[model samples]
Target: MRSNCLPFRADSAAATAEFVRPQRYALRASHSIARCSGLIAAVMLAGCMSAPPSIDAPTTRASTAAIDLPLADPSAGVDMSLPAQRPESLPSNSALARDFMELSFSLESGRAIPQFSRFEGPITVSLGAGAPASAPRELARLVSRLRGEAGVPISVGASAQNHIQIDFVPRKQMSREVPNAACFVVPNVSGWDDYRAARRTARGDWTQVKQRVSATVFIPAEATPQEVRDCLHEETSQALGPLNDLYRLPNSVWNDDNFHTVLTRYDMIQLRATYAAELHSGMSAPEVQAKLPAVFARLNPAGGAVRGLRDDPTPRAYVSAVNRAIGPGNTGARRAAAMSAINLAAAQGWNDTRAAFGWFALGRLSVQNDPETALNAFAKAGNIYRATPGAGIQSAHVDMQLAAFALSAGRAQDAIALVNRAMTPALSGENAALMATLYFIRAEAYDTLGNPAQAQQARVDSAQWARYGFGSDAAVRARAAEVAALARAGRG
Candidate 1:
């Protein structure tokens, strides 16, 4: 996530401290690959059978700114027809059917996910070592919401019998807790479904017999508060069941491209349907189909009129561009794609939020090669972000980005100003790692200005924030120690 060099003392104290850049990884699924068409048919067939069926399975592969410009309406170019009061009311029978099928099947190679099946028993979740301090409370809130809204029997507690393990860890340490494949292998990923192993029954149905369902979710230590929340919601929900991701689903987090970070009402409906008494883990498509009408009637009774809707292609395109830009290898092509997306979004007059994201991606891609261009892009992003409602946290992120760029450009005073502005109190889960980096930059700025005392204090502050934000991982602690030693030498 962070890539830069830091100044350090040449003394023995400094020699003991090692500085490591914070790097982010992507999430990848391990297993066989299956064609999407076959997967869909398999899902349908699975639900159709009344008797227990045996089957062989195949695998398938899968911004900031505050400006005075006219604020583009957040709802503009967006489908706001989905009722806020009742998310369940928005999905038509067709939508529900499609969503249920997708959720019931695992996308990580067409394997059948052994779901909680029934909410009759307790589902305990425990936080692992180095988890964020806020993890327990935030998880509790999510569990409570799910229990109340989806009738899921889940609670937050540790037991040998615990079915879930949630961990908030530094990126470098992710491989130790989750499978290496589950490690953030993709670029621009904040979290991952690190470990999810389940055993199925002899009937090819996922049953309680010899059943073992354990999941581990990895959250990068550098993630901001909002990212933390989204990760908690999405990863935890996926761990429950519905391990597949469908890009076609516009209203569900199940679609990575949709950008619906939090669990939507539609997501809740799907979960409720999965855990519904009549639906079992091993049901074939026809079997599941037989129970669908009743399920929809009970969930949405009066809202069965199907309205075929699709997510806007602009955002999806923009997301693909950003992903390409940050993707591993192929740096030149990635940057070119990012630039092209930014230009396209600008030319097309995409919605403020979407366009702003494109600009932000461009800024990130161009920061090293073209600081001025990066600054301009970030500033435009900030302007658009300020205009969009409910984007205060995002605005903070932009400020941080600007600060990082300024620091790199040797504009110490400007960097300090931006860092100070970005640090204003806001959300609780703001990325501590980013905050620590900001403080580190501020310290460097003070050092450049020959303000030794202030620089030392800023360095101390940076170390403190890094410890709190990144946990006590060996690398993190080493970095903190290096900062302290650097500050001490600067005073000398």
Candidate 2:
């Protein structure tokens, strides 16, 4: 078990200020089956709420404010912006290959498939009748990305014989049925009804199928556009490619960190490898593994055979502890669990990102009960992340938390410093939510410093990103009010 892989939601493994309930990873099992599905949940933190993620976790926050700010002019509508295109950095091929094998051959629960499977021909996708109004537009965008990025031959809105059926159901009904799962994908199922009947049986199991012909992905119809997009990216990738989610993957959306919400460059590379002409459906896991190096060599020749970041396997005890700490429970029990997770990390003598997560968990849970402890935990987590390669974005999440605290304590300079340091990673990572939150923090900091011009500018900058990150004008305003409230708290 990897501590970084928080299933569904809960825990600030991703960088969210508040610890929320972890979204349950949906599963299909039997004594003999090929594999389970991707058990990770695609969780959103609305606009400014960026989470360390680890999963769909809504974990701990030290201080939560809900004060309403002054009303803005209604003439200025909510703003939204698409992230700019950036160059893709390749991790070591060794890491990619490892990620590829684990993600391809197993589920998030570590269930294995004896053989590799994929569609032999072009894939067609269709929207269910119940899909949200935004389904067509989002689907088209996703399709375009798939074609341009992944080189996967996929088209949306196919009228006849669709290979992938995406259904948008009421979030309430879906949530009730799959309590822990925000959304899910299953094999040999084309509709919600089909999935309901076969959910627990081999009929819906990925391992049961030797060749992929059809699958269904259930999403929340009424969810915000961002939420729908996140869900689509996670489940659609699984429906067409890997059925597994790995906690160790630092870049790809295949990890449960839920820090990443879109199909990333790394994700595309894997998909490209999966659909390579040399490889076909029904190949064994070993066979696929053997072919990946050559496949990666052709796909990413720049990625030399260098050793990637040293990764450690997360222990079951630590994972359970972190989960219990972040998941729903009494305060005392939750705090104890968070401490256990921290202790387990220390005992393991690990120095990877996973250990940092334990500290992050502790800091998050301590915010309300023990500010000193929370501060210490965040600092420790930040220090460890700074030393860890590829953890800049992860560390930014912690910085956001600290910045909020700083603002609440009236330490405007400290808050600005934290936000400034984190801005680069937040931008590079294309995390609109984190970016907006950082801007909000900056705005408050500038205001506190008597720099009204800078404060106004910061607010202006936060607008477009906030719309995309938070979904609606109301949500963006809510986040803005919350930031202002932080300052008010310090003054009070």
Worst 10-residue lDDT window for candidate 1 reads 3-12
Minimum summed lDDT over a 10-residue window in model 2 is located at 31-40
Best model per TM-score: 2
lDDT against true structure, model 2 = 0.65
RMSD of each: 17.6, 10.7
Off by over 4 Å in 2: 1-86, 159-162, 305-312
Task: lDDT for model 1, please.
Answer: 0.48
Residue 35 CA error for candidate 1 (Å)?
51
Candidate 1's displacement at residue 183, Å, is: 5.1
The number of residue pairs in model 2 that clash at the backbone is 34
TM-score of 1: 0.49
Provide the TM-score for each candidate, comma-separated: 0.49, 0.79
